[model samples]
Target: MSSTPALFRLAAACAAAALLAGCAVVSVASTAVGFAATAASLAVDATVGTAKAVGSVVMPSKAEDKQ
Candidate 1:
């Protein structure tokens, strides 16, 4: 499972590097909005992880549910 992501990352990096040889990439003024969206998404994920961790430690599922 974990190896797949590494393989994908390697392929994506190679492709990105291949496309960046002396090329002029166009820029837009929407970077701030993109950054804000990414930060908000990351914040939400962290919040959810924290809530799950606390919940599992505090009020775990009943033993019968594991059957």
Candidate 2:
């Protein structure tokens, strides 16, 4: 019957919409994770720089002894 084809079309459209929505959610999640990772990396780098600065102040390098 003609109604059966219309029902099939409606079902297909709903499925496609659901698939696109799921993809959008995944994209947002991936972006958030990437931002977090970048922020963490920057924090670690800053910590390391501070430690190195402290270390240098506490113990002068042997190269400085020649000067």
Candidate 3:
């Protein structure tokens, strides 16, 4: 679970949302897009954090590495 992959997903989602929103003329649609972007950002952050926490549990410590 690399941060790079998670960030790429977030970027792709935002791009898709922006592209899909171009045909609309309503304020609510724009608001929804904004909300979607926010949600995507949060989701990426949470996923990356979770992956790091799990890796910390499974990965070897510095003392183990030295051996």
All candidates' TM-scores?
A: 0.50, 0.86, 0.51
Off by over 4 Å in 1: 1-28, 64-67
Tens-place lDDT digits, model 2, residues 3-65: 999999999999999999999999999999999999999999999999999999999999997
Write the number of the candidate with greater TM-score, choosing between 2 and 3. 2
For model 3, state the Cα shift of residue 44 in Å: 1.1
Q: Candidate 2: where are CA atoms >4 Å away?
A: none
Clashing pairs in 3: none
lDDT of 1 by residue, 1-67 (tens): 9999999999999988877742434233366678889999999999999999998888877984687
Q: Give the higher-lDDT candidate: 1 or 3.
A: 3
Which parts of model 3 are misplaced by more than 4 Å? 1-25, 61-64
In candidate 1 the C-alpha lDDT for residue 30 amounts to 62
**lDDT at 44 for candidate 3?**
100
**Model 2, 63: alpha-carbon shift in Å?**
0.7
